[model samples]
Target: MKACIYPGSFDPITKGHMDIIGRARNLFPKVFVGVLNNPAKRNLFSVDKRIEMIRRAAAGMDGVEVVAFDGLLVELMKKLDCRIIIRGLRTGTDLELEQQLSVINGKLLPGAETVALLSKPETYFISSSAVRELIEFRADISDYVPKEVADMINGGNAK
Candidate 1:
């Protein structure tokens, strides 16, 4: 079976992420939305919470599974038998970073493909950090995140 992986910190999944995931689901037979549990970066939500948020956002999405993994993404992709990695490009920086990582991952995995999708214009400006900021200020984030995610992040206030 052809399978692909979309890996991200997903501190809290945003609408932009859901857009890429929906598109990737259309392209790949099986798409695993891998939540990266990177130790180097402090996360707003725990891995379990991120996974739960993704699952809620992706409810009823067939052939798309939400999972969490720690360690090198390349190693996890290899173990998952995923030959493709889906990435969302929202800006020039995103493209640059993704290209660099693709080259590095290529050298490491040889045949793993990194497919970067352009975010839909409407959601392109949304990012998890911005969502967190909006929540901090008590701004309406209904347009930027799914209701489940919005609810999860809305409890905190600005310092």
Candidate 2:
């Protein structure tokens, strides 16, 4: 079965992320949502918590598996035996960075292909950082993230 890796920090797994995952699921038989565990960066949610949030957000998504990973994304792809990388693009700035990563990943893993899915206009401006800021201010995030995630964040579960 063909599979693709959709890798991200996914601190809280926003709706935009889910949207991309759904889109990727439509193309690939198996979609592996690789949650990056970057210790260098301080995350609001623990890796395990993030995984749980993703699982709840993607509860009924067939063939969608949430897994925590560290190190290079290509390494995770090799481990998953997947050659395709699924990314969500919201703007030109995101495109520039994602394109660069795609080039580097292609060089690292020969035959690797990165597929960029443009975010829907409604969700184009929603980002993890933005959500974090909203949380800091105790602002509403129901529209940006799934209900489960919003509850987790508002329930004082974040670090």
Candidate 3:
């Protein structure tokens, strides 16, 4: 079966993310939403919390699963037997970074490929970092995230 790995911190899953996950599901037989536990960046939500959010957001979605990894993403791809890496592109900068990473990953592993999925027009500007900033400023984020996530963020129940 064809498999793809969508790796990110996913501190909080946004609608934009959900959109990409939905799109990726159609292309790959299995889509693994891998949450990276980066020690360098201080996360608002713990690794478990991030995984929980991703799981809830992707619940009932066939062929989609959540996992937490703390090392090289390319390594995880081999471990999971994934042939593709799903990445969301929001801007030219993102494209540059993803392109470079894709080249590096391809060199490191010949079997793996990176697929860049452009964000939906409506959610092109939304991101986990942007959502976190809005939340910190007390801005209403009901439209940027899922209903459950909106409730979690607004209700102060986000982990």
Top-lDDT candidate index:
2
What are the per-model C-alpha RMSD values against the true structure? 2.4, 0.9, 1.1
Worst 10 residues of 3 by lDDT: 150-159
Clashes of each: 0, 0, 0
Candidate 3 versus truth, CA RMSD in Å, comes to 1.1
lDDT-sorted candidate list, best first: 2, 3, 1
Q: In candidate 2, what are the lDDT values of residues 1-159, reduced to their tens digit?
A: 889999999977899999999999999999999999999999988999999899989998999999899999999888889999999999899899998998999999999999999999988989999998888899999999999899878887775
**Structural similarity to truth (TM-score) of each candidate:** 0.93, 0.97, 0.95
TM-score (C-alpha) between model 3 and the true structure: 0.95
lDDT agreement with native, every candidate = 0.86, 0.92, 0.88
lDDT tens digits, residue span 30-146, model 1: 999999988888787788888988998889789989878998788898888887999999999999999999999999998989998998889999999988777657789889887
Question: Residue 38 error for model 1, in Å?
Answer: 1.4
Question: Alpha-carbon error at 102 in model 1, in Å?
Answer: 0.3
